[model samples]
Target: MYDFEYVKPGSLDAAKSAIAGAEDGKLMAGGMTLIPTLKQRLASPSDVVDLGGLGDLAGIRKDGNSIVIGAMTRHAEVAASADVKAAIPALADLAEGIGDPQVRNRGTIGGSIANNDPAADYPAALVALGATVRTTKRELAAEDFFTGMFETALEDDEIITEVVFPTAEKAAYAKFPNPASRYAIVGVFVAKGGDGVKVAVTGAGPAVFRVAEMETALSGNFSADALQGISVSADDLNSDIHAGADYRAHLVGVMAQRAVKAAG
Candidate 1:
């Protein structure tokens, strides 16, 4: 890794100041992705602002009907949180299923959403469960938060503070993962929340996208059978060595069915 100044901020305010004041400073959360990128010389920032010291930025809380997850909270924390399990077990399950124990313990939800890896798992839950991303500057609905691959609505210096996920009637996530990376080749999150039925797809296309057709069908009847008629086209989906667009297209339906069944 290239030489860089490191700052472990004790408070959210300090972390934001460190990021905003520096020329090319980057926030370091779990470092599951960022550290690898730095090692590969993919990103060479002047400073690394570590958020680990900000104890206030970690943990899970129940906010009435919604579950609030702190920005620096790790996947393992989410997976183990009794409040999350009781409220949205599917989301907890999703976190538990993320890249094994080490990755779960190291990866943070804030980091995952900010980075917006195409194959990452959390975005699907965010979108499907109608979660709201609260940041230092403003709150963003998941619908507006994730824009594209490795991108989000956050400005360079902005930092996420909390993620608010509303309770759902039923929800589940299923992913066909790459053996090595444990990234979803095509993951689907299905939810039947009081807000209505929501279906979000990840690990396909350039980013996590909603399957409107499936959502419409599932809305009327939340079942695996409702997903049978719908089929994702291969044209716009991702194509890679582990699985091509065609294969992923098929998995979209299969995974959708699995998610539906799991949600039930």
Candidate 2:
């Protein structure tokens, strides 16, 4: 890792200040992706501000009809939280399926969404659930929050505080994971909520995107069979050594069907 000053602030305000004051600052939440990148010399920020000490930034709670998950809340916490399981079991299931034990225990929701890895799981959940991302500066809709590959709409020094997800009538996520990394090669999160049906897809393109045709189909009939002919085009999907764009496109349809069935 490149030599850099490390700051673990005790309060949220201090953490913001620490990052704002540095010429090149990076926030560390659980350090799952950041740590590895630093060690590999892919990133060389002048300061690394660890957000682990901010205790208030971790937990799960229900607010009216929505589930609020603190940004610093670990994946394992979400997976094991009674509120999450009872309110959004699919989210809990998705969290439980993230990586292995070590990654689950250490990776934070904020970091995962912020990193916006093309293959990350949380983005699909956020988009499909119509979640709101609450940040230190302001609140953003999930669709607006994730802009592109490995990118977000967050400003420099703006910190995510929590994510608020409106409880869905039914929701589920299904993925074709890379066997070793467990990252989704093609993951789909399907939801039928107050607003109607939503089908968000991840790990198939440059970033998480919705399948309008599938959503429309499921809206008319909330069943796996409803998605019989709906499929996303393979033209823009990622095609790595693990899987081709056509295969990923095929998985999108398969996974979306699986997600709908799981939601039921």
Candidate 3:
């Protein structure tokens, strides 16, 4: 790994200030992705600002109709939270299925969404559940926050503080994960809420996206059978050794069906 200064701030304000002052600064939450990138010499920031010391940035609590999770909250905490399981069992299930024991224990939801890996799982739940990402500077909808593969709407100086997820009337997630890494090859999240039905897919394209046709159908009839004739086009999907574009597209439909059935 390339040489760089490390700063572990004790508070949110201090963390932001430390990053803002650096020429090229990168924030480390769980360091799941960042550490590997740094070790490979892919990223050489002037400073690595660790957010772990900020005690307030980790926890899960219910906020009226929503579940508010702090940015530094780890995957294991989300998976094991009584509040999360009671309010949104599907979300807890999704967290439990993230990586292995180690990854689940060490990876943070904020870090996962911030990195915005195409195959990452949190984006799907966020989009389908209509979650809000609260940063140091501003708040953005999950759909608006994830701009593209490994990209987000966050400013260089901004740090995510928390995520607010509205509890859905019905929600479930299903994915065809890569056996080795446990990353979704084609993951789908289905939900029915005040906003209506939402079907979000991840790992099939350059970024997480919703299926409008499936959503419309599921809105009318919340069942796996409602998705009988719907299809996902492979035209703009990712094709790698693990799975081809057409196969991934096919998995979208299959996984969506599974998600819908699970939601029921």
Candidate 4:
């Protein structure tokens, strides 16, 4: 990794100030993605503001009907939290299915969502569960947060504080992971909530997206049979050696069906 000035700030304000003062600063949550990029010389930042020292951004709690997770909360913590399991077992299950035990123990939700990796698992859940992302500047709906592949609406200096996920009537996640990396080759998250049904898909395309047709079908039937006649077009999905767009499109249907069944 390239040499860079590192600052572990104890407070959110201090972190923000440190980042703002740098020529080209990057926030480091869990260093899952950033560290790798640095090692490969893919990115070089003038300063790395580590948020690990900020204790406030690391907990799980229930606020009324919603589950609020702090930004620095690790995947393992989310997966093991009694509150998360009781409120949203599917979310806990999704957390448990991340990269691996080591990754889960170190990777933070803020890092995952902020990186906005096309194959990331958290985007599927956030988009499907209709969660709200709270940042240092403002709150953004999940739909508005993720803009495109490896992109988000966050400003350069903005930091995610927490995520708020409303309780779902029924929800589940299913993914066909790339065995070598455990990144989803195609993943689907289905949910029925106050706003009605939502079907968010990840790994198949440049960004996480909702399937309106499947949402409509599932709203009416909420079953695998409801999706029997539906097909997702592969034209816009990712096509690489790992899996062709056509295959990913096919997996979308299969995973969606599995997700619906799991939700039930």
lDDT of 3: 0.96
- Residue 75, candidate 3: Cα error in Å is 0.1
lDDT of 3 by residue, 149-261 (tens): 89999999999999999999999999999999999999999999989999999999999999999999998889999899899899999999999999998999999999999
Candidate 4 local lDDT, 127-232, one digit each (tens): 9999999999999999999999999999999999999999999999999999999999999999999999999999999999999999999999999999997999
TM-score, predicted candidate 1 vs. hidden true structure: 0.98
- Per-candidate clashes come to 0, 0, 0, 0
Candidate 3 lDDT at 57 equals: 93
Evaluate model 4: give its TM-score.
0.99
| lDDT score, candidate 3, position 4 | 96
Give lDDT: candidate 2, residue 114: 95
Would you list the rank order by lDDT, best first? 4, 2, 3, 1
| lDDT string, candidate 1, 98-120, tens digits | 99899998999999999999999
For residue 13, give model 4's deviation from the true position in Å. 0.4
Q: Candidate 4 — what's its lDDT? A: 0.96
Clashing pairs in 1: none
For all predictions, the C-alpha RMSD in Å is 0.8, 0.6, 0.6, 0.6
Which residue pairs collide in model 3, if any?
none
Runs in model 4 lying further than 4 Å from the true structure:
none
